[model samples]
Target: MMYHLLPSPYESQEINHLTLAYFVISSLDFLNSLHLLTHKEAVSDWVLSFHLHPTTIPDPNNGQFYGFHGSRTSMFPPDQTGALLHNNSHLASTYSALAILKIVGYDLSNIDSELMLSSMRNLQQSDGSFIPIHTGGEKDLRFVYCAAAICFMLNNWSGMDKEKAKDYILHCQSYDGGFGLVPGAESQDLHVTFIEMMYHLLPSPYESQEINHLTLAYFVISSLDFLNSLHLLTHKEAVSDWVLSFHLHPTTIPDPNNGQFYGFHGSRTSMFPPDQTGALLHNNSHLASTYSALAILKIVGYDLSNIDSELMLSSMRNLQQSDGSFIPIHTGGEKDLRFVYCAAAICFMLNNWSGMDKEKAKDYILHCQSYDGGFGLVPGAESQGGATYCAIASLRLMGFIEDNLLSTCASSSLIDVPLLLDWIVQRQGTDGGIQGRPNKSSDTCYAFWIGAVLKILGGYDFVDSKALHGFLLACQYKYGGFSKFPGEFPDLYHTYYAFTASSMLEESGFNSLCPELGITQVAAKGL
Candidate 1:
């Protein structure tokens, strides 16, 4: 069952659909699947068209960029009811655009930094939070990550208010110390942890000095790894304990009698009742479980050596769809490219390729590459940043770094490193931080995906240390948080990503933070 290019979240649902596009493009870029793209020029031009210039700051309380259109059409200017439908510019799209640009090898030579800064200045909320786009949509860690990514990429952060943003990041911290998407939100999750880690890792730790995003981040990440059914994380002394206590659910229960695992307990469980088991899954396969599990393991510092690497790969490979891509749920009914990315990442993280059928997945991605030279989520789908990231990252993890990938990547020689450095380099934004897409505004979390991707790619050299450092500083919200676009609210997902980006930048400069993710000299876990 193919996903429709949706319109609105409810009726005219568009964000969900378009966001998929972003993920698709970003994944493609990550997989090093640009060869499948039809016309890189047209793709680049299309992505940039979303760049809304002359943005007016909506509020001065926090430095933020105003929202722009999400797709080709505009959703601003409320109807008679004074209800805003949606904006075309989404932080997700912004990040996606930049990611796409890099994938296509556009140094963003045509991007206007100042113009984006102006737009960024307008999207601020007094509490140091930001709306998704220009009055675009809900503000959350996802957007915050996008904002921070933009600033990191641009090599400049002169867009958002710092104090308030920092405070916001601080405010969202739970008693457990892990951060959530919104303040007072329930238990932490992987996406949120990723974002919070990005922000908490920010420099000069403003009001957020005591917040320790990494400490809590470990918890959230640990949990995510547990849920993915990845044994390494489930065995972690602390992580294993946490899951044993808080996450078990009937649906997610390892066995009907065991009830050992929760159904993505950390991820916004509010949406579904705590008791609910299986989610409304698209695929018969549960790739989401695979991804969250892998991400969590990465966060929890799971030693791959202790567990059966084959289990994770086997789980993923067992769920492969006829298309050679993975399916998130187990039905194997609806197969999207996301599973491919998740499966690819799982294989990459495990340092094993047994689970992934690269040839088929690559064929699907290539088939989807439009005449514009950008790959889409599924064959014939529009190109997007998130998806591009998935694709490129998958390829890097697959050890398929080619000249085209190297040119798009930074520090070409680093490709030989365990992590696919070529794909990571392309994730960088013209600014310094990495955005998911081009022409769209920049965001925070891309730093994690793009930055981490770069680290894995071995192109940490391509990043400009001072410039990226400067960008991270600017994206810091006054409330002690980080935003994807400048001048926006901070969220957990983006915060973690931003920090990861900074860590890499600093590491590239020879200043090691937390052992640059997958680099352990020669340890199997490091691989």
Candidate 2:
């Protein structure tokens, strides 16, 4: 069955051909059925074809890993001199390729061990974590394991810094003793099982269901703006009024330092009626909802100056913790890169920076940058897709980072641009969709989250836009909208991001987006 399936068309799994080949060949070898395979030399040559050889002598500092391609599609054509134009060599594929070669009774010594080993060192980061490829990938234990396996197979320790890798592995151990894929992440047992079992179980991309209504409204409004179809809303005033009704108002001019946030409620359910004296019973204003509310208002061409800007900005200060992180609400909530982003967007939309301390917030955002050049939700956590977006977008909105940062002052920039570029470009898998983190399947939304970061950093040109468009087309529902993954139910959240990502790619019938604001340039200008 496995042998028959090998040659059959696996369009969706084409990028994983080498991995699939390993499973079949290793399994057959274990069953003592290796003799059943004919054309042993042909199979060896087929596997060898994926090897990425350096045109010149290996320079570990060249930042290109001379390993093996995962599949033919990932391998680019060679130049006139028979040198590869681009190296898409991946460590996992190299390990699988070597395993298949070994099982086929091929002489491992014949391979250029020195070139492969020396170039492999380029993938290891300063913290001792190994990205899967030299182009940039997630730094985690999976790549470390693959590197170790490759070194073991080659009997060469020159490829990796073992002491650094050891330190990284040690950091991945959680308080409960089990190791995570990366440091400060959850233990692998349940986490890995769920990831393995469910490709459709879309994790809540952002936390808090309290703001679901507002988030949906933002998606609808912003998506309409992106399509240049905001004029389709016949009752634009009614929509604006309804969104503004969620705003919390103070009976009197309150102290700016009163430790109370006056913002917008997420939904009508969170709005409470006033008592007999007209004193409000509850104030459930949230930062995320406020951001969404303002975004909706801006898209509808509402005059933001008419609103109580001073009250909103002054009271918002209460949500900013001393460390410069922001809680979404005045009461309490998880303070992370997400809320900081919301706060920054809100301030940007309002044209007011008095709400939060820019210097303090900038300092806080800097702390969230993980060693791999991607930002996590909080300090010391594993880098994530959404958090990385928040950090970069927030910085762009706050004016701490320049637009097209890579082109401007990357050398003197506060953040590490080169590593960030490497990490982001690697998110685009061979399938064309972008994953949020390394070693994960691509999703529809990350095309915006991570894609926006690339646009801001001037690294957007590095992405394979055609492949990404193909992936997005696959996720499109026959009825309408897009699913988180292909062949699943479509949701507003994913659909909105898909539209924005498509716009960034210069898709027709869509307006260009202002990446930092997550809205159209026209809408942002109206603010």
Candidate 3:
């Protein structure tokens, strides 16, 4: 079976033919059945044929990865001068080829170890991720593992930047104490599909209720705006009116000292009926919902100045705690970076600052930065992608931080720029997708959540945009929208962020986004 061609079912996997051969030969060796194989020299020679060699002295920076082709098809024909086309050499295939040679007891030293190791350096990205091919491929843990295996077999450390790779592996550890295939991704699990299906089918009741309908509306409206297709939205006025209806307006100018918050309800279910005197029986108004409502209104080209800005801003102050952290709702909720961001975005959009004390908010945001450089949802919490975005974006919106701080006096910057950059750049997994926290699966939402942070800090170029594009394409739904993870169903939130991330990459047909506002630059300018 090892000597024969793979069956028809494996034709689609022909690109991985060398890997399949490695599996067979390694298994036979493990089973103590290696003696049954005849013509070992022939097998060794066949595996060696896949090795890519440089025509001249090896140039690691020549933009070609010299390794092993996975199969004959991947090994393109030589040029007119008879020089081999080395473009298709892959790290994984090279590892497989090397293992096969060792299994046959071939003299490993006969191979051009120096050339192989030097050329392999071409695949390592600045963030310590390794692309499988020189021509570009997913940079993830799998490729990193393959590179390590290859180096171990050849006894060569010169092939890669070991310190960089080590840092990348360390970053792959998730908060739940397991290593993901890539940084900021969830730990690998065999039951991921089943668990994801269950999550979609049977969401927690509390979580289901916590799904702010107004936020969903914001995602939809903002996505449309980003796509430059807001014109596709029929009855624009009606949409604006519906969003406005969610607002909790006071009969008169609201007192900033009032404990009650006059904002927007997350959904009608959370909106209490008014009493006989037209007073709200229960002020279920939430800051998050209010932000989403205002964002949607902005997207729909509504004049925010026409709304009750004084009442909204004054009542909004009631939700801000003395610590400068804000609860999502007047009824009280968790005080964290998320709500602080919401408050900041709300104030920025309204062109008002009376809602919260900026100095206190800035201090609160500064305290949330962890020793590792990433920001957490709250002070002293684990650094997270979303929290980092919330912290940075809030500061940007409030004018406490400048755009491209890394380029503009990073040393004097309030946050630890270097550590933050180190933490964030590692979030780009081997698959090119960004994860929100360490060891979590790369989700579509983080593309925007984390990508925006990079953009703000002038570190967006550090991420592998090509790899990210591939990941986004994989997660794209056949009909429309994008999924949280590839091969899953799509949702409004992920789809919206996917659009914004694409826009950040400067993908054509997408309107430029105002990262701080989470809206199109055109819509933000309307404010």
Per-model TM-score on C-alpha atoms: 0.43, 0.60, 0.61
Which candidate order results from sorting by lDDT in descending order? 2, 3, 1
Where is model 3 more than 4 Å wrong at Cα?
A: 1-211, 252-254, 277-279
Model 2 C-alpha lDDT per residue in residues 120-147, reported as the tens digit of each score? 8989887677888777867789999999
Best model per lDDT: 2
Q: Report the lDDT tens digits of candidate 1 across residue range 149-264.
A: 77777766876776767766665665456777865344223333443344235435433532233234443343232223123333456753443222223344233222111222
What are the per-model numbers of colliding residue pairs? 165, 0, 9
lDDT of 3 by residue, 1-527 (tens): 64466678898999998999999989999999898779899889899898887665656778778899999999887687756565799999999999999998998999988888888988988757789998897788899999899999999889989988887776666545677776534321212232233323434543574548778667766776776666767788998899888888766555666688888888888877778776666889888898899888888889999887777788788888888899988778799999999999999999999888999999999999999889999999999999999999999999877789876755545778889899999899999999988998898899999999989887788988768977987786655667899999866667778889988976544689898888999988884
* Pairs in clash, predicted candidate 2: none
Residue 362 of model 3: what lDDT? 93
Q: What is the lDDT of residue 192 in candidate 2?
A: 26
Residue 17 error, candidate 3, Å? 53
- Predictions in order: lDDT: 0.52, 0.83, 0.82
Per-candidate Cα RMSD to the true structure, in Å, reads 26.6, 16.0, 12.2
What TM-score number comes out for model 3? 0.61
How far off is model 3, as Cα RMSD? 12.2
Which residue ranges in model 1 land beyond 4 Å of their true spot?
1-236, 243-285, 298-312, 332-334, 370-372, 402-435, 448-467, 507-527
Q: Per-residue error at 262 for model 3, in Å? A: 1.1
